[model samples]
Every structure is written in structure tokens, then in C-alpha cells.
Target: MKRPELVCPAGTPAALRTAVDAGADAVYCGFQNATNARNFPGLNFTPAEMEQGVAYAHARGAKVLLAVNSFPTAGRFDLWREAVDAGARFGVDALIVADIGVAAYAAEAHPDLRLHLSVQAAASSPEAIRYYVREFGVRRVVLPRILTVSEIKDVKKEIPCEIETFIFGNHGLMVEGRCSLTNYVTGLSTNMDGVCSPAAQVHYDKEADGSVATRLGDFTIDRFGAGEQAGYPTICKGRYHAAGREDAYYAFEEPISLNLATLLPQLMAAGVEAFKIEGRQRSRAYVRQVVGAFRGAVDQVLAGEDPELADLVALTEGQKQTQGAAGSKKWR
Candidate 1:
């Protein structure tokens, strides 16, 4: 089987170094602005930090993929433009972008720099994938976390660019780049602002009945019992009351994570060029552990040994995980 590139996340310069040392083939991060999707407070790097991150990764024989993945607004197009330029200036190995306008600018101005389609583009079909490749010279495309392994193989056969998929981390079932719940509540657009359910609007409070209520912008989304684990309060994962049901339940997606380490061999054989881990806002320890574990697992797969999986249950949100749609035909 062909070994795939192990792409990991780096929220900070420290996480970049940690991921590289943990044996990541490439690390993807964004600038601390609205240009990238994971633009959470206190995360991502500045231009100088990105330059240093590139140097750190390159010195260790690893590559840095800058995530200028967020869509720019009409008048603020310059933020995205400057981001594409910064990638070229910092000597980043590739730019992971979702906006066609940004991609066009990159292709026109910095044709030498590599381009990877972000999952935000939702280019599952071969025709859609080829459009980006044909229009923008995109070299790779990050597949949405909704395709089965067989489906991915089928798409790979018809597409020219390389395929990358999430092997671990957030398994949010919302169509990438399409959710607007955060904007409706807090007026923060996930696409244009690169933040969803901004931390400033999140609140956790102890309720009167010994339950913990999770609120987003003064609206309580869910209440956890005394012993139950409270999930991160994103609109998709929050529970809601319904007329038919006596109890409240998750309306859209449940709080769960994706763990596909068991399918490493199948993914490699399916023409997947890269495996991506998807937590850019997590802690440095989380980066080190997940990257290290996946590194060992991928190496073992290449060596034809049992990938003695490390116990990663403690790191996942709400201690819950699923194989997602990669193994099953059913969507949910």
C-alpha cells in the first residue's frame, strides 16, 4: 500500500514544532485573522510566526500548509489577498484555500505556490473537483468528512488532483462552509469571519437543579445532569425541546469525534494521498498526543504490523467517537 502524507494541525508556533517532532509529514495552520477557518481567539500565527513555523517545519524535513481557507467578504477582499501573498512570502509549502477568488489571485500572482482545496468547497463529485483543478491549478483537495472509503476511491479515479481526508478529530456533519446558525445567533459568519459559535458568546452556568446549562449568547442550548459530560456548545450539537418528545434531544448533530485509525490501510490503498487531523484550536498536549499516535499508527501500517493504537479516548470530546460515514453506507 502507498503510505499517505500525515497532515496535522498547528494552532500555535509551539504546536507546529510539537507536531513536526511527532512525525507529521505536513502541518496546516492559519494566520491569526479572518483569512482562515479556525480563527478562534488566541489561536493561529502571525506572519512572522508563520515564517518561523515554516522554517521550523522545513528544517525538520516537514512542510507547512497555510490555511487561507475562509471566504472573504466583498469589500474585505484584501485580507484574503494579503493572506495568499503571505503564504508565498513565508515560503509555505502549500496554501489550503476554499474561496475561488483567493485561489484565482494565488494562481495569477504566485503560480509557483501549491494550492489545496479546502473541505469548505464541498467538491465531492469529480466534475466539481476538476473545476477547481482546471481553474486554479489546485494540486490537492481536502475531501469533506462525509464520503465512504469506496466513494473516495471512485472520486480519486476521475480527479487529477491529490485527495486528502480527515482521519481524526471533529466529525461535525454540517455541510462544510454552509452552516449559518452561528451567524443567526451571534452575528458572526463562519465563512467570512472564520469563527463559529465564538468563545466570547459561550456560557456555562450551574443550574438550580444541579445541572449545568450551556448557553450561546444568553440562550441556553443544553443542560447536562450532575454526572453527565457537557459538550462544546455549537448550534449543531446542542439539544432542543420538541413538542412530540417529552425530553429534549439533539436536533441536528450529536457531540462526537471521528476516529479512523483502523481504516489506514484501506485509505492508502484507495488512492488517498494524505490523512489530516482536524483540531487547530486544541491544546499543545492534544497536538503532541494525537500527532504522535497517528504517526506511530501510520508507520505500523506501512510496516505491515498491527497498529497498536494508543488510548486516545481521553482526548476526544465528551469521550465519544465514531467511525463516521467512512465505513457505513448510512449517512447518520
Candidate 2:
């Protein structure tokens, strides 16, 4: 089997360099604007920084994939078009895009530029995947975080383009590009604005009972006990009070990460061309640790050995991890 590529995250220019040096085959990042999903302040790259980052990664034998993935709001499509132009001028290896308009524009504007369908596109079927490959020349498709290994294997057989799966990071249960929970609370669209639980609106309050209340705008998302670690307030991963239940519980998905360390070999066998590590909102240290560990693991798996991966629980969200839907198909 061909060894799968270890695609890592690069939230900042420093993180991009860190990922390349840590053995990332490719590092995906976005511009410092609403054109990409991780539009949080102090992250992403400027035009100069992106050009420099692309050069840096190329020098280190690693590829840079620019994310022009977020939807272009009406009358603001010029911003997205500018991002695509900048990516091509920067000589990026590929453009990870979700919006059809953006993908079509990239394909036509820069026919030579490689376009990979972003997971935000939420295209998981053979028909849907084929449509992108047919219409926009999408070279690869980042499958959503909801498919099982068997399902992925089946889909790979029918789709012409390469398949990229999230091997680590967020266990995204909500449908990408369709989630409005964040906007419902904060009035900032996650799909259009590219800001999910915008940090500027996030507030933490210490309750009288020695617990911490995490609030996104005026609404309380979750409360953590003094002994528990507080998590970021995202609407999907927050705990809420349900009328049928007395105690508050996670109404959507819980705060946990996806760890597919042991499934590396199986995923490769299933014809996965790339293994994506999601966390464009994370730190440089996080980029280093996750990329380095996965680097060794993928190499070992390729060498026909059971990889011994480092303990990554501390790096996980809520200090917890799950194999996610990739490991099982209980509902289906």
C-alpha cells in the first residue's frame, strides 16, 4: 500500500514552520480573514506571511495548502476572490475550498492550481464527490468526520478523486457549513463569517460555588467545577438544560477529540491518500507535538510494524479522545 500523507495544521506563520520542521508532508492554513473558517484573531497568515510560509514549506520539502474554504457572503465575494488570487500568486501547492463558487472560480482563474474539496463541503457520497471532480476538477475530497472505515472503503471504490480523512483533532459531529448554533447565540455566522464562538465575545465567570461558567455572549454554554478544566465555549460542544432532564447535559456533541493513531494502517489499506490533523486554532507547540508523533507513527506503519504513539490525552479537548464514527457504524 502507498504510504498516506501526513497533513498537519498551521494556524500561524510560526506554526507553519513548526509543522514543516516536525515532519509534516503538508500544512494547511488560511488567510487572516473571513475567507477561512478559523478566522480567530492572532491566527492565520497575512499575504506576506503566506508567501513566506509557502517558500518555507517548499524549502523543507513540505507542501502548503491554502484554505479559501468559507462561503463568500453576498457583495463580499471580492474578498474571497482576492484570497484565491493571493494563494495562486503565493505558489501554494493546493487550495482547500468548500464553497462551490470559490471552487469554480479557483478552477477557472487558476486552472493549473490544485483544488482539494474541504471537509466543510460535507460531500460524503460517490455521486456528490464525483460531481465536484466533474464540474470543478477537485483533485481530492476531504471526507466529513461521520463516515465509517467500511463506508469510506466503499466510497473510495466509486470516487475518482483522492480521499482525505481527519485522522486526529476535533470529533466534528455537526454538519459542516450548515451549523448555525454559534450564530443563533452570538449573531456571528460560522459558515459565512468564519467565526465560531468568536473569542471577543467569549466570557468566563467564576460562580460563587467555586465553579466556572463559560458564556458565549449573554448565553451560558457550560459550567465546569473548580476541579475540572474549563473548555472553550462552542455552541455544539456546550452543555445545556433540557426540559425533560433535571440536570444539564450535552445537547449536541461533547468536548472530545478524535484519535486515530491505531487506525493508521487500516486507513491506508482503505485507500486514504491523506490523513488530516485538524487544529488551525491551536498553538505551535500543539502543531509540533501532534505532527511529530504522527510522523513517527505513519513511518512505522509503513514499515509494517505496529506503531507506538506517544500519549496525546493532555493535548486533546476536554482531556478526552474518541475514535469517532470512523471506528464503528453502530447507528447505521
Candidate 3:
């Protein structure tokens, strides 16, 4: 069995180094600007930082993938162009891109550069994957987390390029590059602006009854009771009043994270070429603990032993996790 490469996240230079030292086969991150997803404050790297990060990861026998993954809006095309140029300049192992224009630019402008299709493009089938491979020379496709292991195996059989997938991180439920819940409420596009629930528009208030109300701009996204855990203020994960329901419930999606630790062997059997760990906006401590744990898990799996992964659940979002659509075909 071919061992899948362990791709970890690097929100900052320190996080990059931490992930590498903690057994990351490759570290992926974005620039400080709004060109890539996870464009949060005090995160991402500067040009000099990216150069240093790439050098750091390369020196330690690890690779660095730069994420210039967000779509470019009209008249803002140069921002994405400059990001691709920067990736080539810094010598990133691959550029993960979503926009077709950006992918074409990378292919033409830097013929020697490697291109990996981003999940934001959501190209799930063999036909879709082939189109990107033929048109843009995409060396790998980050399959949407919405696929079952059986589905992934089927897709791999027909596709020509490598299949990379999110083994851990954001519940792949939200249609990548298609989510507009944030835009509808905040007047900012997560796909275009590279932000979901931008911090500038988020507000929290404790109700007199002791429940806390989390609001994104004018809309109250969710309210948690005194004993309940308050999750992130994103609109998709919030509770809402359904038309026929008497009370509030998770109208869109719940606060569960994507955790495929238990399915490592199945994923490898499904022909996943690479396993990506999400969370570039997380702390260096998070990188060390989670990456180290998963590193151990991958090593054991590669050695033909059962991977021990229960310890990593402490880091899951809202202390909750799910296999998403990877394990079960009937998963909603």
C-alpha cells in the first residue's frame, strides 16, 4: 500500500516550523492578504515569511504548499496574480488554487510550477477532474469531503491525477465556493473576500437570562444557554427557527468537525494520495499537538497497525467530531 503524504496546516511562520518539527510531510499556508482562504487577522505569512517558511520546511525534508485558493472578483484579478507570482518566487512545492483563471495563470506564467486543485472548486467526479487536469495541468485534486470512501475509490479509478482530501478540519458539508450565508448577512463574500464570519462584523452579548447571543452584523446567529457551549459565530452552524418547528434547531448544519482518524486505512485503500489537516488560523500549540498526534497515527497505519487516534478528539471543534460523508453513504 502506498502511504499517503501527511499535509499539515501553517497559519504562521512559527506554526510552519512547529508542524515540520512535529512530523509534517508537507505544510500548506496562505499569504497575509485576502487572496487565500483563512484570511483572518494576525494569521498567514508575509512575502519574506513565506520565503523563510518554504526554506525552513525544505531544509527539514518537508515540502510547503502555498494556497492562492480563493476566487478573484472582477477588477481584483491582479491580487490573485501577484499571489501566484509570489508562490513561484518563493519556490512553493505546489500552488492550491480554486479559480480557473488563477489556475490558468499559474500554468502559463510558471510552466515549471506544480498546481493542485483546491476543494473550493468542488470538482468531485472523474469528468470534472479530467477537465482541470487537461486544461490547467492540475497535478492533484483536493476531493470534496462530501464523498464516501467507496465513491472516492470509484472517482480515483477514472481520474488521471492524484487525489488529495481533507482528513481533518472543516465539516465538508458547506458547498465549497458556493456558501453565501456570510455574504447574505454581512454583505461580504466568503468566496471572494476569503473570510467567513469576518471578525469585524461579529458581536456577542449575554442575555439577561444568562444565555449568550452571538450575532453576525444585524442577525443573531445563535443563542446558547448558561450551561451550553457557545460556538463560533458563523451563520451556517447557528440555530434557527424552522417553518414547521416550534423551537430553534440547527437549520443548516451543526457544529461538528470533520475527523477521519478512524478511517485512515479505508482512505488509503480508497487511493487517497495525500491527507490534509486543516486549521491554518489556529495556534502553534494546536499545530504541535494535533500534527504530532496525527503523525503518530499515520506512522502506525503505514506500519500495518491500528492507528490510535482518540487522543486527538480534544482538539475538535466544540469538542465534537464526525467522519462526515467518508464512512457512510447515507450521511446527510
TM-score of each: 0.98, 0.98, 0.97
Q: Model 3 over residues 67-174: C-alpha lDDT tens digits?
A: 998989889999999999999998999999999999999999998999999989989989999999999999999998888898999999999899998988767357
lDDT of 2 by residue, 1-332 (tens): 79788999998999999999999999999999999999998888999999999999999899999999899878999999999999999999999999999999999999999999999899999999999999999999999988988899999999999999998997755987799998888899988988999999999899888999888999889999988865558988888899999999988888889999999888999999999999999998899999999999999999988899999989999998888898876422
- Which is better, 2 or 3, measured by lDDT? 2
Runs off by more than 4 Å, candidate 1: none
- List the candidate 2 regions with Cα displacement exceeding 4 Å: 330-332
lDDT of each: 0.92, 0.92, 0.89
RMSD of 2: 1.2
lDDT of 2 at 108: 96
lDDT of 1 by residue, 67-149 (tens): 99999988999989998898999999999999999999999999999999999888889999999999999999999988899
User: Which pairs clash in model 1?
Assistant: none
Candidate 3: global Cα-lDDT?
Answer: 0.89
- C-alpha positional error of residue 135 in candidate 3 after TM-score superposition, expressed in Å: 0.1
